[model samples]
Target chain A: MRVLAFLDGTLADPDAAHIRVDDLGLLRGDGVFETILVADKNPRELRPHLDRLARSAAMLELPAPDLEGFERAARKVIDSWIGGRELALKLVYTRGIDGDPAGVPTAFAMGLEIDEKVQRARTEGVAAVLLERGFGPDVAERAPWLLLGAKTVSYAVNMAALREAGRRGAQDVIFTAADGSVLEGPTSTVVVAKGRTLYTPPSTIGILPGTTQYALFRGAEKAGWTIKVEPIPAAELTTADAVILASSVRLVTRVHTLDGVALPDSAALHRELVAAYESEY
Target chain B: MRVLAFLDGTLADPDAAHIRVDDLGLLRGDGVFETILVADKNPRELRPHLDRLARSAAMLELPAPDLEGFERAARKVIDSWIGGRELALKLVYTRGIDGDPAGVPTAFAMGLEIDEKVQRARTEGVAAVLLERGFGPDVAERAPWLLLGAKTVSYAVNMAALREAGRRGAQDVIFTAADGSVLEGPTSTVVVAKGRTLYTPPSTIGILPGTTQYALFRGAEKAGWTIKVEPIPAAELTTADAVILASSVRLVTRVHTLDGVALPDSAALHRELVAAYESEY
Candidate 1:
């Protein structure tokens, strides 16, 4: 229950501090953010992590943060934590404090709490359900009024999708457009092993460009695995050799089942991806 | 620049109050909100506005506010404000603060400042540009996320799209998916007059189900004008007899051009939509 927020460069107690109602992060979910894993006293993929944060900010048109200062702050936060155990560190930058009430927000940043259950699930893979693409089909057919490739803070639907999956006794949800194209997990990128070739939907399909997945793909390639970034339909999920969700802290966790069907072993791919990320980070 | 926040059944200064960071509105954009025109000391479409607010909240699974109570609070806020004249009123209700950091936010509301230029544009109209579909065209089309029909607070991209349009020297932006399906405007519903019929992209295409647009469509129907909700294209925008951005405050402002291509008799459609909204709301 102890949660802290990294407000710009300063850490504040989220429970006691008050955020203004006009903060764009609260008003319009108008901003970009990143969630990096804090493992063994170090933030994994420091440079690429900052790079992705900048990209998300640019895609959303928010002002960029001082990356050098931010990195130092992040490390400071990690170093100051009394518990040296593994933790999920989230850095969210909103469009700022005030502007045209209806206009794009200016910029703000703060850390958020990560669910302990998610950490447990990372170590022990869980089941997921295929939710009917709530956003509808053609969502990824082209660039949206805003690109979906950015990790903007406006993620209400993303969390809702996962909640729906939980109601169905699944740990997570994988979105499928109305046309049956598999997009990505609610909070993670997906990878499916098809024979010797690993396939994932390209970022062009409106999925957040997954940094962890990219690292995993690079690792898979170095291990002599054929990798393809193409649209995969929901129906083909069960037929793959294995299915795994890739993210910063989780590294990669095998999906035991999608819906009611059991999944094949994905330990090998998960192991490879984790090793790749750990080695590089 | 004074703004009031409507929380539960009370009003507070948005700048003076403190909000929790764990509010679902901030963490996930998991809420719905509305901004109405407070003209001549009265709130426009007050009843329908609440209905839309309730519907949007339902879509996000947030608890609904006390409708009658909310109205009382709204009236109180308006009464205390500079009466008459023109002012913008925003009603935002996030799930009351909750989740792991706290729990799942139940619901909350707040008000915001209105742009003077928006009201002026009603008579002057404004220039518009046809940009690629508003954010998440692919996700909306293929993955089927929330059908941009809900007025959920996750509108970071919508605001960004408008800014992008402004950057292009247009007052507003019309989103067209890469596949060439014309969507809605950034903050307004797009209505095109083609011959004797009116056509607008369907809300099913992930466009925010605009309250003002709904009223206008209803008014147009009563005025012996046929209305169609169908997929429009960028090419059709150039050919349309007129195009208007429809919203609560603006009612309808004709778009003089799309990407620099001129359209004719803009004010005629503007008046039509305005009349429709006023009569219906």
Candidate 2:
């Protein structure tokens, strides 16, 4: 197990690195974060992740993240990478410690080894359960304070839903809104393919605008694949030619089964997405 | 600002203490926590808080917290308190660092000084805005994975709601359901008075059963005041004789106005409730 964290994932000791006990990120999960895939000792799609981080911070009313500083830190970690061939670099920007007169925001870059199980899912695919995310797009639209579009760390419910999935003998979870619209995976974007067109939920539906999904779509556009951002009803998933999950770390994971029912196979489409993510990078 | 944290708040350095970078508590906000009021160098209503912590942990499917250990730690912190006359002791139990073979759970007890501003709200009262919590009781009833009734550290939404309150020029917020039912405050419980009875949203509505509210009600019952746990429609708040918020730290906070409109004053009832909390302790 290799561990390192710092301004650039450099000097901080993995065993000793710690944030303030009073840090809002620790106490209140009051923060935003991004996980970027570092391939070839370089951060891929760096700018997009930073942009999303800034957007997330803005949504939380947090001071704009120091993106330039984060960029430097992320690059340093990648340059000195010691873990694996591909690294999952995480950047966390928190609302600082409690009662600080300075109001300094706490930010750090850390590297994590992609879990073997998560990586294996990219090829072997995964079984998932559909769980209620509790709100529809309409509610999210009217309730900005819910911070649905932002990738804040308040993910207890997401984790719980995943646990519930596991209890049902599934490995992953796809969240659905009350209106019966397919939302997103616990930590990934949900994408469905039928024919040459790939469909995903729009940002208006309060799903995180996935960085990897965007990259794939941009790449697929040139590869003659049509992309559509629309509301996908829960029933649509069952009939879709392929159901896939995309994230920064796990680039392309096909959902083989949902609620114990087999989904249509799309190994060819899945491989294309993986290639697209890599080729675009 | 005074600080101390340890098995008994005796040894750990406040400035140096920190959790790992990938702590699930920090990474995923996957944890349960309780904030208890400490008076006279003792943790008040300690057992109730511990019980809630266990319940919350069970809901998250984390390992049951070692309640006996937590009790001893709480006592230690209280024994060596060096803060104000009253302290807000927070107990946090997290589902350890990621990928640990042992799957060790992280637990800590920290003592924080009662903020002067929060203390003032107890008497001066607070103004609040009603914000959409985005889901109704029915959704929560069906979705245990939502973790609605548990007080997990995943408080990003709660903190965001408070910021929204500040933006609306209010000091606090009352979260309402999609069905227009009054839910709870960002960090407190909702209690409204009408004549001799106090009505709060029932536990069925998925609100954290408030410890302070419970103590107050128990005391109120002895004082010949009736308490009812029921759904409060948004409109009912306007006609209520008194609106109040209760929490472990900020006990007996009168909500004098809702959405900038004045709620009927019930100073005598407010005073009585305050006395109830104090007398019960």
Candidate 3:
């Protein structure tokens, strides 16, 4: 399989590749991680994404990855591209090899071929559901053993929610804490257009801070729109004029339904965010 | 750099090992693990330890390890022993490699050597202190995002706590929640003897269920000692005759202090549990 490898800002092959049974990330969902999308040979929103990765690593006390090195390697991978096809590049750093000093972490990066369908889905809109079987917000907040905000490698439950949504015939899932507060989609940031204002959850409330969503908001302001960061109740989600899931590759895709309820037209908001993200480049 | 290697229950030379970093365990902390003492070339309390491993895997919906094969491989490693001395063995299994499947997991296994110094420290007793850092317990019961009860590989935090304890000049650290409920140590189980009954925190409280402690409790009961599984407060620990940290290799070691406060002798309980572990097989 094709993969991008790097360390300290140089592109290379992974020195060692294969998961040991002892790795904490996969075994206990015991880690956090961040994924940045590389568009048409350029990593979108590099600074904000790396900044979030550092913040998450610090929260978990995991040693910070070599961000500068990572950026160089990522660029190398993008530069190696001979075509202008939009690519999905992911940088994953796990608490490294077992039996080593716990401080230094194992890191790797690779490019994936994301389906072109996601870009089309953004305008056409995708179906979604509110995941009901989710952990409580306080548990997500206070459990030291819980890797809440940090995107450590432990992501079983998160992936499970996606599968459950798929089995029910939805393209993605939005989660609400036990207390009924709307969180985010499995791998995307949640955004809703209320009038002309763009709203997203604050990361401090245990959501992965989305670099793409932040950029969209910045572009939104320039496009003459207001932005709001607030705790949204799950009940309020279905009433949004347009609901969207934002990630690097997907940009912003509108949610056409919540559970089984058909959402009202959100094509205009979707178009606005797409144009905003693209124009910023 | 001595290490042990086990695969599908067969002992292999460490250099002959093979694993893929993409294995679910390494990628997602998507597996369970156990550490057991190799006493007189036998895995102490084998049945219960294997049972616990199966239970933990079940909790994560991963396939159980091949216990019968595991037994053969473990014995093979024991037979290859160049020295006839006792040692500690760690067994780790992960879901094997995959192309980032959403939910399905793969599995693999490996063995490693535990420090001989840990065994030596048991005879002299170790100084331990309680960290004011709270490890909230209620969340384990309520939070679906938590794998608190399982001894999964996502143990970076546990190791971090131990490193932090060492930095503070303490041999070990115990965690207490904000409300003052005592939790387990970073690598071992915490047990305090009060009057006649022996007490240890329940695994349902988000700490690992200790194999050594479980075996020792059975040994204690067989020897007519009263045992209890409940929450112990920090205040109660300071008042105890002895506080012991139990694990496979250490067996049962006495705690001499709690956050710098000296404690009375714990030789009796330590001796009792050590004999109990030794008498097995």
Candidate 4:
């Protein structure tokens, strides 16, 4: 793994990426980040990820990140990494040290190999547990301060949900709203298929709009598959012809079982979706 | 300002306190923390803060922190600071670097002069706004992954709420549940007075039980005031004889106005509560 960060005006060793202890990002999780997939020294979906990062920063009211600088830093890191292997490129922007209300933001980029666990889950379908996200679908519309649509780094609950799934002998989790409407995976977007139509929960319900999922949907739509974005009740998931979780690094991963109940297999559909995702990226 | 960290077994300068950028605490906000007020070189309410930190760690399923090690680090930092002035002593413990599941936790202690804003809020009271917290009181009991009662450092929402308040020209916020029940302040516990009764929202509502509020309640009880724990609607706040937000760092701040509605003065009660808080510490 090689880490490079945009410090001052150029890339530096990430080991030197020490932020002040009082940086609001570390102290209050007041920041946003994006992870891009690098294949063959190219960052996949760079524009979308950067746009989302900007939206996230805007939602948190942090200063807008210097995207051109970030791009240079990202390219530097990707160029330094070993070739012919998939790499995870991460960009982070924090609100900087505390007590300085309008302080300059801390920005960094790093490159590392994709985790083996994500690879395994992508190849062999994962058993996912259903967990309550503790929010209703309407909460986001009513409470913007919750930062539900933004990809802020305050992910304690998401991490805890994953840990809870691990304790229950599951490989992943799909968070459902208090009303039992399927929300999203801890770090991925939930996608379901019925006949020729592919369905995903609407991002309006506070789930992050997954960049990979969006690209996959674009490809799916071009392939004559109907794409629907709407509320997906938990009960509806079990009846779908196929189910999967999608993310930038993992691509598209089939969901074999949900809440201990074996889901219908659609290996052909999984292959088609994975091909679509790869082709689009 | 002086910062020291307990790395392995020794205390080192906080500038040397950098953890891996991939540390889960920095990456996913997987951590717990406490801020203690050190007045005249004595750390106030150390035991309660430690207990809360342990409880918070337990909630996140992080390994139990070494309390004795933390105490020693706190003492060392306090000793290094000049006396006679108040300092904010912050203790933080984070799940270590990413990909190292069993990695040792990162623990640190920092001492800085209390922020002028906090000092002013404590003495001059503050105007607060009521905002929806987006969850019902029962959310935590039904969904533990939310980690509501735990004071983990994933405070993006809290910081956002404060920022929203600031945008509205208010100094603080009192979060209300989806059901219109008052929850707590972003950083303080909401306390209300009606005649001789001092009421605070119940901890079962998933609010972080305020340590300072508990101490104040104990002292108030000793001084012949009735203490009650119950749900308070936003409308009820206007009718209370006195309203205040209390926390360890900001001892007791009267609520001058809520949502632009001026609250009645409670100088005698505020004085008595402040005296009680100081005496208890």
Candidate number with greatest DockQ: 2
Give the distance in Å from residue A217's predicted Cα in candidate 1 to where it truly belongs. 4.4
Better of 2 and 3 by TM-score: 2
Tens digits of per-residue lDDT, candidate 3, B1-281, equal: 33454545544445432455456565565666777777667777777778888877776657767777666656666666665366555556666554545643443333356676686768878888776443366766665345567777666556556666676677888877656788888778888888777899988777778888887788777877799999898788878878989877777888886677678777876787678655555
lDDT by residue (B1-281, candidate 4, tens digit) is 66565633355655553666776777788899999989988898899999999999999998999999889889888877864488888998988777775788878888877878988888789999999988888888888988999998899999999999999999999999888899999899999989989999998898999988998898888888999999998889998988989888898889988998888987777988888777786
CAPRI quality band, candidate 1: acceptable
TM agreement with the true structure for every prediction:
0.86, 0.97, 0.82, 0.97
By summed lDDT, the worst window of 10 consecutive residues in model 2 chain B runs over: B2-11
| Model 2 TM-score, all chains together | 0.97
Candidate lDDT (C-alpha), each: 0.72, 0.86, 0.70, 0.86
Between candidates 3 and 4, name the one with more favorable TM-score: 4
Q: How does residue B184 of candidate 3 score in lDDT?
A: 83
lDDT of 4 by residue, A1-281 (tens): 66666733465655553766777778888889999999888799999999999999999988888888888888888777874478999898888777775698878888877878988988888999999988899898778899998998899999999988988889899999989899999899999999999999888998899998899899998888999999999999899998989888888999988888888887888998888877775
| Model 2 agreement with the true structure over B123-222: per-residue lDDT tens digits | 8899999999988788777989999999999999999999899988899999998899999999999999898999899977878999998988898888
Docking quality (DockQ) for each candidate: 0.47, 0.82, 0.27, 0.66
Write the residue-wise lDDT of candidate 3 on A76-140 in tens digits.
76776554476767666766555566445666566656675776676677888887434455554
lDDT of 1 by residue, B34-88 (tens): 8888777778778878998887777676666667766766776677676347677
**Once model 4 is optimally superposed onto the true structure by TM-score, how far is the C-alpha of residue A116 displaced, in angstroms?**
1.6
True contacts kept of 2: 0.85
The worst-scoring run of ten residues by lDDT in candidate 2 chain A lies at A1-10
Q: Which ten residues in a row have the lowest lDDT in candidate 4 chain A?
A: A7-16
Candidate 1: count the clashes: 55
Residue B196 displacement in candidate 1 (angstroms)? 5.4
